[model samples]
Target: MQQLAFYQSLWATERRRPGVPERPVSERFDAVKADGYHGMAIDLGAMTLEQARATVPEFARTGLGGLLTAFPQSVDDLRPAIRLAKDIGSPFLIVIGQVMPLSVAGMIPVIREWLALARAEGMPLQFETHRDCITNDLFATVQLLDAIPEMRMAADLSHYVVNREMLYPIRPEYRALISRVLARCDSFQGRVASRNQVQVPIGFPQHAKWVATFLDWWTEGLAGWRGRAGPDDTAIFMCELGPPEYALTDARGDELSDRRQEALQIRAMVEDRWKALGA
Candidate 1:
């Protein structure tokens, strides 16, 4: 059976309560495990290797495995992150780009370098579809894909939906683009988005259409993954509904809804959809 892993945005959690101190890794790990998540994805950009290493045992204690999301400033810096992933026995390293290359040709070398780094370390890495990085603009990623035929991506469509300010009921032309992305996508991320906002909670009336749109995208993306993958391969759809500021708010700065509850709801929805796909 394939497993679903939830990526924890520990930094976002900490940012929500500005005056309060951030929770310890142990606390975060316990909370996620209790919520019934099988695994975790930890973004280690803000921490030192030593600090990240120290936190690994906490994940193990909760019977929860984790993949590290490393922000590598240079190609060579990826090795340490891959080494850390190997130490934790993570199946893959999720790479989030920090630099934006000027041209698709420039981006090709960067992808090659990352692939080499992962291959040299005997680990696997997938570039995340995110904004403000090498794949910042959706069109640029399409261009990069043309240059490198075998590149794999972890699809976080929320970014692209927001990046392009995608209109609802998705235009027919845009649907074709989305289909192309689904075909090549190796993994998925969960978060409802509108053209203007990336992380809206799933229940509010105003957000209903957006929520429905994301679920449809998730369905399409999941089916695509299943078609390409064998029965033994796990498909990871990370429910990364981050805390406030990533989670939207009103003028007063209060959250749109309870994010913890929203995440659990999203998890339930994903499970139901996965079951239907199998049937």
Candidate 2:
């Protein structure tokens, strides 16, 4: 079976706790493992290279290893983070581009630069579909794909749902566009979103329609991946349901429920979809 991992926004959330000492990376690793997660995608956008290197050993201690998600400003800036990923035994170096250029043509050089760097360093790389980055806008990303045929992506459809403002009960036209994205994606992310909202709690009555919409998209995406990929290919599925603010939090700063449980639920859903596709 393809491996699944959780995304850790540890650096971002650790700072949110005013009085509490930041949770040890070991603690974060333990938390995910206890929740039945196989691995974790370390979000390094909030940390410097040196900080990331210092923190990775903690993840290694927990036996969790996966991608390093970064928003490096320059291609060369990715060197240490890539090295850190290698040290942690993560096979993928995932980049969610942060610097946006004036035009689609302007974005090519950045992609080329990162591609060159990854190639030179022997690091596997994939761009993530996320907001406030070079791939921020869905329309622009389509253009970028046409320009660069080799560009691989990790699909986080929450951003595109918000970018396009897709209504519930996905229209065939919108579904077609999404299918294009699914065709290009090598990995999938976990999050349920409506056209208007980026993140919504799973299992809420109001969020059910959007959740179903995402499930349908995931089914299609996974089926497409399985069909296109060879027997040796492994497609990653990341359960990235974020915490506190990204998750719904109650009073007293505690999460409404367990975010880890929510991630597991999403993982199960994806696994079921993949199995159904196989059947």
Candidate 3:
């Protein structure tokens, strides 16, 4: 049977602002496990490599599955992250490469180099669709997919939606672009976004249409995964509702909505979609 796993982002759990005290890593891990999450993602973009290394023992303590996300500026920088992912028992390492080039043609060899490094290390790597990374542009990313037939992606559709400044009633051209993206997606990240914002409060009435759009895309992505994946493989869906900048802040720097609740809600939504497929 195929499995679907939900992972909570440690970065999302942070509440570092003016008044609120930040939660300890231990408390955060405990909450993630207690909330019924099967895994936790350690984002190197938000923490130092040593800090990420320090958390491995805690994964064993909490019995939560582990994942590592790296923002490597060079292909060589990714090797240590690959080893760390192996140490943490992560199924794969998620790469959001910071090396941005002028053109998609320039990006092809960089990607191939990173994939070759991971292959050499005996680790699986998935390039993420995120802003400020090699796969930042939707149009360019589509070209990269064409250029590299074996490339698999960890889809975070929120970035593409905002990067393209998409509006409701998605155009056929944009829809075709998104379909190409979803077809290559090996993993997914959960965050509702409008064209203007990277992260929107999912329960807000104003965001309903965009929420519906993402759900439909996620369902399609899952169905595609079902068709392509091995019988016992697991689909990892990460709830990545980030803190501060990603979360909309009010006048006093307080988030407008409860992210913990929203993360759980996203988890439930994906779980329902997976089950509805009924193998």
Query: What range of 10 consecutive residues in model 2 has the weakest lDDT sum?
Result: 3-12
lDDT on C-alpha atoms for all candidate structures: 0.78, 0.76, 0.93
Candidate 3 lDDT, 1-279, residue by residue in tens = 999999999999999797768988999999999999999999999999999999999899999999999999998999889988988889999999998999998999999999999989998889899999999999999999999998999999999999999978889999999999999999999999998999999999999999899999999999999999999999999999999888999998889999999999988988999999964
Over the full model, what C-alpha lDDT does candidate 2 score relative to the true structure? 0.76
In angstroms, how far off is 184's CA in candidate 1?
1.7
Task: Return the candidate ranking by lDDT, descending.
Answer: 3, 1, 2
Top of the candidates by lDDT? 3
Cα error, residue 73 of model 2, in Å, equals 0.5
Off by over 4 Å in 1: 1-9, 12-15, 46-48, 250-252
- On TM-score, the leading prediction is 3
What would the TM-scores of all predictions be? 0.93, 0.90, 0.98
Against the true structure, what is every candidate's RMSD? 1.8, 2.4, 0.8
lDDT of 1 by residue, 21-57 (tens): 7787778777878877777776776568888888778
Off by over 4 Å in 3: none
lDDT of 3 at 260: 97
The clash count for each model shown is 0, 0, 0
